[model samples]
Target: MTTRQNSSADQESAAVVILGAGPAGLTLGNLLHAHGIDCVVLERSDRAALGARARAGFLAANTVRTLERHGLADGLRRHGRPHGVCEFRTDGGRFRLDYGSLGRRELHTVYPQQDLVADLLTHYLDAGGRISFGTEALAVHDADGVRPVVAARDAHGRPARWQARYVAGCDGRHGAARRSLPPTALRHQCDHGVSWLGLLAEAPPSLDAVGYATHRSGFAGHMARTPEVTRYYLQCERGTPADAWTDEQVWDRLDLRMRAADHGPLRRGRILRRTVVDLSSDVVEPLRHGSLLLAGDAASLISPSAAKGANLAVLEAELLAEALVGDLAHGDATALERYSRRCLAHIWRAQEFSRWMIRLLHAAPGTDGESFFHESLRRSRLDSLRTSRAHQDWFAENYVGV
Candidate 1:
C-alpha cells in the first residue's frame, strides 16, 4: 500500500489533533492551517480512497458557500453542477419547489461526496496539510497532565503515539473517538424506521436536476453527478438486502417509481455501486468534554432526506475552527464554551426539517393508512412551501444557502 512519509522527529506535539480525515476533519484542519495553527489529523484509511465508502452526495447552497469562502470551492466549481430546483412526484401529480423562485442565488450543487472530498484533499495537500492514514487511534485520555495520548500503528504496522493540547473527534458514527465520550452526553436520537438503497451508475441522467418520486410501490430519488453519471436512491423496508433483488429487478422498480407519467424514459444505466442504510438522527449535547470536542457526524447527524449532512458537517467544522482560533488568540475559551449550544441551534433545525421530510416521503408499514396520511401531508406541505413567499424565503435562507 502507498503511504505519505512522516517526519515525526521534529514533529513535537501539535496544538490541536484531529481524528478521522473526512470532510469535517479536513475542513477544520484547512481553516486552522490557514490561520497558522498546527494540527495533526489521524485517519484509519489510506489516501486515494478516502471517500470510497458509500454516503451522501448532495451539497446544499449553504455548504457550497462555506466551501467557496474557505478556499476549497475553486476545484468544486470546476467539477460540480449547480441545481435550481428539486421536485416531488406522486401518482396524484407532481409539485416542484424552485429554490430560484425563493431566492435570486443558486440553491444546491449536484456533486458527489467522494468528488467533493477528493477535491478538498487535493487542495489541502497542495497547501501542506498532513493526514496520517492507516493509523488507528486506540484511546483518548483527556485528563490533566496527560495531554490526551492518541495511540495507533502507522501504515507499515508500526506502533505510534500522538499527544496534543486538544483533540477534535470529527470521526464518523462508528469511530472510537465518539465512543470515548461518556454515555450520558448523548442527548437525543430518533430513528425513522426506513432505509434507502443507494445506487450509482454510469448512465444518462433521467432528470435535469434532483427528482423525488413516490408510487404505491415505493419511493425513488434521482440525482445527476455529471451528464453521464447518475446517483439514485430507492426507499425500502429496514434490513432489506441488496442481493435479495437482482440488478434488473432494482432498475425495474426504479422505473416504476420514477418513470414520467407523461411517457418519458426516466433514463436507465448499468449499476456501478449499491448499498442500504437505515435513516436516523442523533445529537450529543455539550459537543466538548474536558479537552475533547466532537464535530460532524461524531457530534450530530443530518438525515439524508434533508440533504444536509455534508453541509452541516462542513459548517460545524468551520464553527469549531473559528472557536479554536479565538481561544488561541485571546487566551479565552468563550467561543469553545458556546460551541455545543451554538452548533445545536442549527443542528436541531435541520433535524426537525429532515424528520419532517422523512415522514413526508417514506411509506409506512402495516394497514393504518399511514402511507396515505403521509402522502396527503406531503402535498399540503408542498402547497404551503410553494405558495407562501415568506415561508419559501425562510427555507431558502435556512435550508438552502448562505
Candidate 2:
C-alpha cells in the first residue's frame, strides 16, 4: 500500500503507462510484466476500495479461455462455479433453458468481480508490477507525439508526471481517458430508456438458476453471487431513487412480479447495496489516438444486461498487450496497426447482444398502442425462445458467446 508522492517536476518514465487498476489495466500490466516490459498502473482509488467494488459475475466461456490462456485463471478455477441454466417466468407460464446444452454447449463461470480484481491485483504485484493505487490521472497530453505525458496527482495532493512510449486508457467512461479524447473522435451512443434497481442481498438465491421474470408490473431478475449472497434487479422508473422502497416493500414487489404464489418464496435477508443503473450503450471509433490506446469502458460502455462489459475489457486487454509487446520487442507494428479494428469488431458484436437482452427483459413503460405493440413483440420473442430450437440456439450462442 505504498503511495507515490512527488512534488518535484522530475518525470518518471516507463515503456507503458496504464490508467486504472481494474481488470483491463491489471491484465495488461501482468502480461507486460511477464514479457519483461516496463509498465506502471495508476488508479484513483485506494487498494482496499479497488478490491471491494462489486460488478458483473458471469464470465462467458470465451472469457474463461482468455484468462486460462494468459495464466490468469487460477483464482477463477479455484473458486468459480459453472452456471448454464436460466429460467424465465411470464404471465403465460415459466420455462427454463439449459443454455450449456445448446448451441456450442458453452457455459458461464460465476466469479464475483471483486474477488477477481483482488486476484488480478495480487498476481500483478507478485510479478513485480508497479501500481500507484491512490494516484489520479488528470490528463493525457501530446499523445500524437512519440512520447506522451500523463499528468497525475498522488493521494497526498502532490503533482506527478509520467512520460511513456505509450499510454493505455483503461480507467472508465468518465475517467481522464475519455475526457482527453480529441473533438475529432466519433462517439456513438444510445439510450434504451430503461432503468433498473440493482441490489445485492445477503440471502441465498431464490432459484438455483438465473431467473428472469417479466410481469405487467415490471421485470425482476435473480442471480446467485455466492452461497450466502444474491444479486437482484427490479425494473424501475427512470428517476426512481435506489432507496425508493423499504425492504418489505421491495420483497413484496418482487414476489408480485415473480409470481411467487405459483412458483416459490424468495429467501429474504438484509439488503447490503442498491444502485440505479440506466440502460445505455456507447462506443468510441478507432479506440486509439496517436500514442494513446483505449481499453475497457473507456473504449466502449455496454449495459450489463448481457454481462459483457468486463469480458470485453479482458479481451481487449489481451489484444492490446500482444500488439504492444510485438511493437516494442521486435519492431513489428502490424498487430498494433490493426488493434482498434480487431477490438471494435468484438465490441460492436457484444453491444448488439446487450441491446437485445435489454429489450428482452424490459417492457417500454407506457400504455399507448406503441407500447402494447412492443410488448407483443417481446412476448413473441420469448415464445420463440421457448418453443423453437433455432431461436434457442441463437439466443444461447449470443447469450454466452462474448
**Predicted structure with the largest lDDT when compared to the true one:** 2
lDDT of each: 0.77, 0.91
lDDT of 1 by residue, 1-402 (tens): 012133375233677878888889989989988887778788888876686754666688778888889888986688777777777777657767777667555567777787777787777778898778888776676523437766666788877877776788888887767767866676588888888898887787887757888777878988877788788889887789866677788888888888654636667768888888688888888788877888889888766886778888899999999988888655778998899888888888888878877866765555578766766776677667657888677666555652
Q: Candidate 1: where are CA atoms >4 Å away?
A: 1-12, 103-106, 143-146, 261-263, 369-379, 382-398
Candidate 2 per-residue C-alpha lDDT over 200-316 given as tens digits, one digit per residue, 9 for 90 to 100: 998988898999999988899998999889999999988999999999898998888889999988998999999999989999998989999999999999998888999999999
Deviating ranges (above 4 Å) for candidate 2: 1-9
Clash count for candidate 2 is: 0
Q: What is the TM-score of candidate 1?
A: 0.91
Candidate 2 whole-model C-alpha lDDT, 0 to 1: 0.91
State residue 112's C-alpha deviation in candidate 2, in Å: 0.4
In candidate 1, how many clashes are counted? 1
Lowest lDDT sum, 10 consecutive residues, model 2, at 1-10
